[model samples]
Target: MSKNYHFIAIGGAVMHNLALALLSKGYQVSGSDDEIYEPSRSRLKAAGILPEEKGWFPDKIHQGLDGIILGMHARIDNPELIRAKALNIPIFSFPAFIYEQSKEKKRVVISGSHGKTTITSMVLHVLKSCGLDFDYLVGAQIEGFDLMVRLSDAPIIIIEGDEYLTSPLDRRPKFFHYHHHILLMSGIAWDHFNVFPTFENYVDQFSQLAAMTPEKGAFIFYEDDPNVKKIAAEVPNTVRKTPYREHPAVIKAGQTYLLTKKGELPISVFGQHNLQNLQGAWEICQNLGITADQFYESIASFKGAAKRQQILAKSDDSILFRDFAHAPSKLKATVEAVKVQYPDRKLIAVQELHTYSSLNKDFVHNYAHTFDAADVAIIYLNPKAVSLKKLELMDESTLRSGFKRNDLILFTETKKLKSYLENQIYQNCNLLLMSSGNYDDMDLTTLQKTINKQHS
Candidate 1:
């Protein structure tokens, strides 16, 4: 029998994708989001599950419903939730629901402060290339994958585990819900300042995730990160613990080649972080019965997850790249990667302080020296964002002090930032835009066109 599922706050990226996945599986899926945004709205509309009306209706919730999947966007006092609770309908947090569905399958969870999406994407790419059928839940969309979440009868499922809170009502972190048979930890860095006040509290989440692995499960982690190394050492002896560092590779004429016994294999992705991510993925794939040669052949074609070192435009003399790097660790790795990729070219790096952690005056100091790799480093923040986030106004001196780079440039106006970018000489230069959010809604396509036109 096809189960009927209703989602509250269905407009979230993962929630909408999960709804579509269930719909594809012949389940009756209904969803309601007070306000839906582009991409999610359009995709849900295409799936024929877009609610005809916005906001919750208590009438939509009843005892007949098989389940209610709660998204993080919905508050604990949501009307739909209240109705469902009153009716005694089973309500599951997003992660809990996913766990319920994949409990029968072998779960491979990639968890860390950074590189979770990239590592998960890598594993998915290799599995798909090797003709393996598997279900997956990745945080970011990847090339050739139409959806970010998938559920099927496949014996295995790969999950990109996030450390954020599961839902408004469920205080547990999302990764805690996943009972992993194969767990991979890339690294641990303190993030989500609003939820985790101190660095130690944030690090404890990974230790908890490590403990959730079954006795016979495998724990793969990056040994380079001291925190991850410490966690791996403390795991129960019953679980198989494997550690990896950056894959041995050489860069020749701006191309990265993996060093293997077979020979140097060229790959589409670069950077030490990505190499480490690849190593983590390789270990997971190996545990899944994929041969080393087959893994290499498949991984060489992996282009990387969207927004993680994605190229926006390129020309003979100049190029433009964009990354979803808002956290301090991600910011440092991305800047270093682009610089390493084009050593001879000038790197013009622009980052937006949009996340709660990045915008917080108290947390800004963590970003010090992260942009040292960029020849011209620029940080952009809109005052309106600070007001919206309910954070204190951070002055230019505070930002300058936080970065500790005398040459750092700061901008509060999108127009001024755009103007400065437009006026820059692109000859033999690489432009890198880093942000979890858009630069105050700047049209990147238009900016790319303007750069192309100027170069033409």
Candidate 2:
């Protein structure tokens, strides 16, 4: 095992998880980051491996280091990275190393523009429930899993296969490196426009990944998504292709259960997209020799991954849920899920335009008609954030013009959005705040508490 490795931009969730996994395996790990956030910050501290509070240090890149793992957040011109290069030390992008390390394990690569995190979590949940020990690298914190990333001498390694560029130096998508014995292409939607630039180009990445799987490998696909179905249909006869649909769901007295072929199985996760995620997980687990009974038993205790349809606060009548939904498809699915779960309750779906793609002036039109399912839809944008991302400014009017809902409310200031939420009548209403950001530094917990207080 390689020892004395250093991680560049180690404060990120994935970066820190890799650091901790290395630490657990008795490797001397050091890291640097320009900034850090909670959970990642505290977890690093707990591991007794917190990096120096400041930015990278070139002096830290000595010749004794075994290797350098570059995170996606770090630029190529990073000082320590340049210094490491000068010394001719080996460097591995996060995904490149993950692929190298898990080459022997039967890799199950879960890919999609959205719901990859949830699907990975769902499979891990079922695996754990069945007492099957497997290594995984998931995007979010599952309820029972102490760490989001795990590496071990297990026979299987399940990974959330992101379609984004691997690293600054490696342009191949992360999913490409995974030598998948079982490949699940959830669907392809246009995302990471800063990289792929066109819809067909984005779809091509998945097509390539599908082609990589061996003849004995199974390719699980979404039966409903046209892009996924089309791509899966194009694959050769050697790879076994399995298509999945949303698990049949019924909401009875505020509970969602899967109407499986075996029986009615209950789960802590709800919503139609999650139901689809469960279906995909079930098929993959089944292919791994897990029976339907074992899959349902594991799913019963799965409380969901962090920030993906996470219920932050709840009172008697109204609950506040926050999600990592910035894509048009995700936003639509999340809003529809909340509506279906509580048919009689009003829904306030608030979203922040924080991602580079979401903040793009030309791409805002893709969000048209997405939030029509919500009773009240709000989009919050900050010019400062736009400046930070260096994206073109899209004013409230230009954004509103593109949205099909004429009555859709828009806010440019965090304070105004906070105030509107504070003053609103939330009775018999469930508030769903969706974003890839903090909504311009506003406290989501404060909003959750404020809304719950009124209902209580």
Candidate 3:
């Protein structure tokens, strides 16, 4: 008999993907969410699993259900959760359930503050090119993957492991539940202000994860990061510790080519951070029994994960790119990447302060000098976002002072930002947008088109 599973708060990105994965695996799947948004809503509907009603229906939850999967969006008092508890149905957090499903396979968990999605995507790209069958769960949408999560009878599963709190009911970090057989640590920087509160508290989570690596497992880390090196060194002798740095690459005429024993391998992605991510992915692939020659040849065609240094539009002289870079370290690296990639072009870098940490007064100071590489630096924050986050509306002077840049341009209004961007002459320039949000739902495609047209 097919096992039946119910997902509470199914409109979430990973939640919907998991539901679809389970459904594809011949399991009976049902889900409910109080609110469903675009992409997720459309996907669930197409899969024939969109709940008849928006809110919870306790009648949907019965004793026949084999298990319940909870998302981070649900509250402790969620009615379906209450019903599930009453019926003694096994409730699994997202990460926990992922571990449960992949128990029979070797789990490779990519854990870090940033670059997790990119590394995971790179691994998947090479594995697919080599015709290796593997399941994966990545945070962002890769170019060829239809869904973010895939579960199958494959021999191994790659997961982009997040350190955020799991479900509302589970206080532990999500990575704790993964119990990875192989772990890849990308450089860590402090994030998630509300949950972590302090840098020490944040680092502790990674330390605990490192300590959890089993005797037979491997821990791959970035040697360039002092924190990563320190953590890796602490791991017992029983576990394998492998450290990697950025791959050797050279840029010629705005294109980057990896220097390999086989020869110069042309790739679509650029940036030092990306090179480092590639190296980490290469290490993981090598450990999985793939040769360097095959990995390099296959990875040459990888463009990049969506929004992680994704190119938006380009003209002969002016190019536009967008990245999901919010943290201070990522901001600095991204800005520098653009400057180095196109040294002749003037760089106009714009970023939106959307996350709770970015909006917090205490955290703003951490962004100092992050945009120094950009010829023109601009910061945008939706006033409504500040108010919604229950944060004080930070004035221009405050941000300027925090960034330690007197000439920084600040915009609270999306209209003004758009107008400013549209009016600018982008000749011999590159525009880079960095944010976790969509710039207050602005039409980025139209904006990029206008900029490119203006440039032409």
lDDT of 1: 0.91
Model 3 misplaced regions, further than 4 Å:
454-456
List the candidates' TM-scores in order: 0.97, 0.96, 0.98
TM-score of 3: 0.98
lDDT of 2 by residue, 1-456 (tens): 557999999999899999999899788999999999987899999999898676999988999998999999999899999999999999999888888888888989899988899999989988887888799999888788888788888999999998888888898898888878998977677888888888889889888988898997899999899988888888888989899999888888677977877777677778889988888988889988899778777788888888888888888778889899989889988999889888888999998888898999888788888898899889888889899998888766777777777778889888889889977777788999898888766866676777668747
The clash tally of candidate 1 reads 0
Per-residue lDDT tens digits for candidate 1, residues 1-456, read: 989999999999999999999999999999898999878999999989999999988889978799999999999899999999999999999899989999999999999999999999999999999999999999988999999999999999999999999998888899988888999999988899999999999999999889888898999999989999999989999999998999999998788999999999999899999999999999999999999999999998999899988878877767799899999999999999988978999999999999899999999999999999999999999899889999997877888899888778889899999888987888888899999888877866766875566546
lDDT of each: 0.91, 0.87, 0.91
lDDT of 2: 0.87
**Cα displacement (Å) at residue 220, model 3:** 0.5
Model 1: residues with Cα > 4 Å off, grouped in runs: 450-456
Candidate 3, residue 102: lDDT? 85
Go through the candidates in order and give the clash count of each. 0, 0, 0
Candidate 3, residues 201-245, lDDT tens digits: the string is 998899999999999899999988888889998999899999999
